[model samples]
Target: MTVVHVLLGLGWWLVAPRGAQGVPRPFLSLHPSREVTLGDTVTLRCRVPHPNVPVSIYEEDGEPKWQWDRVEDTAEVSVNVVTRDFAGRYRCQYNMTALSRFLRVSNPVELVVLDPNFPPPVMSLSPGGRVKPGTDVTVSCWSTYGATFLLHKAGISAPIQRQSLSRGNTATFTLYGVTQSDVGTYGCSYHPRGNPFVSSHPRSEVTLELEEGGPSMDHPVSQQPAPRPSLSLHPSEEVALGDNVTFRCHVPRKGVRVIVYKEGDGNYRWQQDGVQDTTEVSMQASTNEISGRYRCRYEILAPTWATDWSDPVEMVVLDASFPPPTLSLSPRGHVETGTNVTICCRSPHGATFVLYKAGTSDPIQRIVTGNTVAFTLHGVTQADTGTYGCSYRPQENPFISSPIGTSMTIPWHRDTFP
Candidate 1:
């Protein structure tokens, strides 16, 4: 007798323990289908497809999470108490010596554990302005529940710094005299001071900007003359709608009031005064107001002379008014395992699109091309079955994600006989 069974996310059949009499093919299974909350018991059963074979298990991209003793028929691995770390993908395999074939490995199984008490912390960049080289920048991570904070820069493996928030749940990491090298994405996470073992999810990311010289009229940094402040956009020339877009105008010489403006043919736009030091000005962009160009300049007090306006920065928008992209699966309605499926999204006006599966925040694939975006999924199995949607943002303004407009369903692929 040969054993055949379904495993997590494995859409098709696996090669069984070949030529073995009465041997069951092993597959990794979890007791809790949805989530294993705190204190919940989760059981992982490795049905020794082969009569008596030793088995091993790994979690998340081949990290050994758990393993079991050699069992003749079946091996049961149970987590009496579940933690946040246990919430991840898992797979297992076993060996059958008689057939000279290695253990048939199972597909990956994802485990989710919800912890409501320790929510992720929030990270903010302070004095958020046009940071010049040799200027100081401060990054702060704050949490209501956790006492320990971890700061991460884009490339560094370990946390750049792990600090205890001695001040009322707020930990501040300051980078003094920043340079072009410090220009990259940054984020923060927190773990309970006492638990030490459990860590909350990381907060969103932020970036520090730097340019060689100040912005100039109709240019990024100023080019006119010396002693003038330059202005630029926090991100690139493009900006998304409903996103926190910031414009900064700064001078190497400190102690000045900055004003940002949009220049046009005999018309313009600008900011308020009475602000001192390096200050960040945030504006909520509206659809009607987001079109056209922006520029900024600084005013030195006492002398009362204003610097030349930095070059105009174009602020693009992923116009919400543009029709949203459409999602469609190949073969129309239902699909089966081992069938190569094509997921296509089209937009007449969009320059780029992102495909997102249900329950996941990050897009599976991002297409930066013409109107049509296609993601081909090979032999889609159970794991790929879910509601999927796609949205397109103007390539220059990717930060503004279009509101999700359409979703398609991938039914569980069932084995069928023709």
Candidate 2:
């Protein structure tokens, strides 16, 4: 009798077949594809060269999940309602009783069961008006989760067209020279690629209506397009890691919906706010992911027209949480009235330094230069006798600022010099 044992490698237990090196392993394949929507049926086929062979399918290192006593050259295993438990790597092995007791193992294939609760793709028809028979028709499908898209007709069991690639969660299907028979409802669904693929559920559908005769010359009058909105960041574009920044989108028109977009967000709108022409959205710079290109556009709900996207603006987040700059006074601590005192702030990196007096909203002086900047206070008086601190913003990123450095107290007194 031959025995099969398990071996551990790379933190995973692998079972190797004890079949002879010259023997060929069984071939494993999926019926529809590697990805299946939840509650959908999927079939796994195991084929061997000879008939009446014993085949068994195993997942990972567990025991056989399916077994076939004496199938033809091919054995089929079906999953009626695919569930979360059916999502994993599967492999098949077949035993040859007459040849040897050892089993021949086949290569593993991954099965991904998509989630049923995820939102489906949106379908839209081009040439919003009636479509003519001899003219080409285009159907577009867009979704937040985009990978592989399938265009399905109402009465078709299989997809009419399949798109292997998509442009940022959007795919377009064209029907050439449509006829009267082409008048039907069409819908689309997509499968997003990941560890476990995601399927678009509750798909959206669109209908195609053909014009009776010659194309109608009575086209709707064109209206002016909406004006583009301007986008600006409060407190500048560059911000500190933990700070918050507000994105302001403004346009000339009023009572319009404003939409914001982040570069890689695909078909999903990043954010929307304000019924008026102007809108403000605040976001925290908690992670590096927040740093990206952003733009905005305004739409008129009554007319149902949107303006072109505005110019893109980049936001940069700086990690400025380090040791504070050093503050030093030229005259040490105490200073006499009618005398000159120089206060210098030094930081590790080249930055702009600002000197602030205690209990004051405004800074005494702000200087933009190298790593160090000095403030000269001539004819110092009683008013200068207060605690002062200095903060610096890196020259490369002016919007980001470091915490206030150590403070120093200056004592004021009457001039007693010769």
Candidate 3:
């Protein structure tokens, strides 16, 4: 009985203390649910109920991994500014003879690190200022302050080019063999030693413009120096009847004078001679007096040189004859319901005729004939009464007709009489 009692006491003490309260299950907790970017830190704690048992703490998938002992009920693990590789699942466990419970994985905390010191680099191409396919081009990446630089391209999973410019903050990425498939958006990143790395916002966007077979400008003039003497004209293209237009000439280079002339008008109408430097000439638009092509000529008068006429540019004066087109009302200018009225279009000389009604933008109808044309208004009504006009297209270079026609208003109440 004494021996049995001693054995029973020892067994009870060992079993009861160990099974009831050897050490509470290990627990892991995090101070912050999320970590700040770049220059921030994260703290992870492992809690053990009893101070007698040993505790080991280390980080996995971060910098280095190790095991530690002697924590005194709690163990703290700290890491600074997590990186892309540091982003993953982490766990802490208490080990005495074997691994203890995992403590619920510490809620899977995530550490976010941002870089505020380094700014994104700027990228640019040279030569034509446009990215062309199958052409050798250079891409330059320049940053304000960064540690490492990387350049990525297509077909390659990793960075195709890299440079370690420890001297300055600028790096250049050269593509030795360029092709059509090489066109794409490129990104760059900068990482310092202790701080987190920052990626630029896709600064380089490459577009491929293929060269088509054509007579391209072989020696195209990117820019031209100011001419010795310059001439300018108002109403460069289109002009209206009775509208006055002006022409001016200026000498950008010294010792040059300008002469103005009106071509194909029998003889030169006006001439300004020996006019040192810059001079101008003007012409009036007349009904029958002025009409044809006009141009200017520059002469090195003081330097004893022959006069050279600049390119010939043409202008036309518009006139559709006087008294306009006479619009005569048929059937005594009044027609009964369901009756037809003849609207004849007449002018002196018009290859094409356009007729319109007052207050309406679109032409009522058009007629193309030698000199005169006509439109028959079937079932004439009160809506047909309004002002009317006719214009003619000339056969000459101007190709625009004169704006002269007739205006007539038919009474709406007259239709009720007949």
**The candidate that achieves the highest TM-score relative to the unseen native structure:** 2
Candidates by lDDT, descending order: 2, 1, 3
- Give per-residue CA lDDT, model 3, range 1-418, as digits (tens): 0000001112222222223233355666556643345546767677776564555543322322434556677777776755554433344544443322211122233333435444567666543344443354666667765545666554334454455443676666554223323444555555443232233333344432334431122312112313434456676423456777677666544555455554423254444665666676655665433544445545443322322234444454555442344455565433454356555556565544555554554444454456666655544433333356656554332235565543543333332422
TM-score of every model versus the real structure? 0.32, 0.36, 0.27
> For each candidate, how many residue pairs have backbone atoms clashing (under 3 Å)?
19, 0, 4
Candidate of highest lDDT: 2
Q: After superposing candidate 3, which stretches have Cα over 4 Å from the reference?
A: 1-232, 235-243, 273-278, 306-308, 320-348, 352-401, 404-418
Candidate-wise lDDT, in order: 0.57, 0.63, 0.46
Candidates ranked by TM-score: 2, 1, 3
Q: What is the C-alpha RMSD of each candidate to the true structure, in Å?
A: 20.6, 27.4, 39.2
| Greater-TM-score candidate between 2 and 3 | 2
lDDT of 1 by residue, 1-418 (tens): 0011223223442322345434444677778653455677888776665556667776533334565556776676778555576655566766555544333556556564545556778778866856766565788877887666767777654455555443487777765445444567888777565343356653547887765562222332222433645666676444556666777766666656666654321133454555554456667666535544555666544433355445555565545666677666676555665566676777776655665565554455455557887766544444344556667755334334455464444444344311
lDDT of 2 by residue, 1-418 (tens): 0011111222221222233445677888887987777888999999887788889887643457899899789988889645666776677877766544445667677676767666778888877667776565788888777666777778555566565442467777765445444567888877664322345666778998878763222322123434567988888676778889888888877877677765443342444534566788887888655765677777554434455557666675656564577767777644554456777777776455666665554454565557777766544433344466667756434334565444444443322221
